[model samples]
Target: MGREFSHIARRCERAVVTAYRELRDGGRGDLQAFGACTTLYRIHHPEASMTEARRLVAEWIDHHVVRGASSPTDGCDCA
Candidate 1:
């Protein structure tokens, strides 16, 4: 059952990623992109509230932004 749950979780993550990419490519702002992703998330999780979806998407984006900003190449001057 755990393996099955893991697979479902991975699929959900991929869906969120795809939503984010589409929103970004469409030139949406951060808040708009997050709102769109939250809507996408809710489609997969009907029981989830808008507030909960927003929180989850915000945290996910914040985590990736922090990780990317802290990467060695982010501000390096290497040629």
Candidate 2:
């Protein structure tokens, strides 16, 4: 499981990082933020399928959510 996530993390690093930063700065709810990220990704990668964009967004969200949960005082209102 960890190895799988590591592989995914490497594959989607750019999208995940950009999406996380954008969503965090925007301070929007998960659904709205994820949707916005997906749209932005699609715009940047027009050839990319919606499913791929959505999957990247979902993985990014899950990773950050878990990270935030682990660090309650990271100054990110993940709570």
Best by TM-score: 1
Backbone clashes per model, in order? 0, 0
TM-score for each model = 0.61, 0.51
Please write out the lDDT profile of model 2 over residues 14-77, one tens digit for every residue: 4554565667677877677778878876776677789977875665566644453221122111
Q: Where does candidate 2 stray beyond 4 Å?
A: 1-16, 19-26, 68-79
lDDT of 1 by residue, 1-79 (tens): 0111122234444466556756777888877877887887788777877887777666545544424322122211112
For model 2, the run of ten residues with the poorest summed lDDT: 70-79
How much does each candidate deviate from the true structure in C-alpha RMSD? 12.6, 10.4
Candidate 1 has its poorest 10 consecutive residues by lDDT at 70-79
In model 2, how large is the Cα lDDT of residue 38?
A: 81
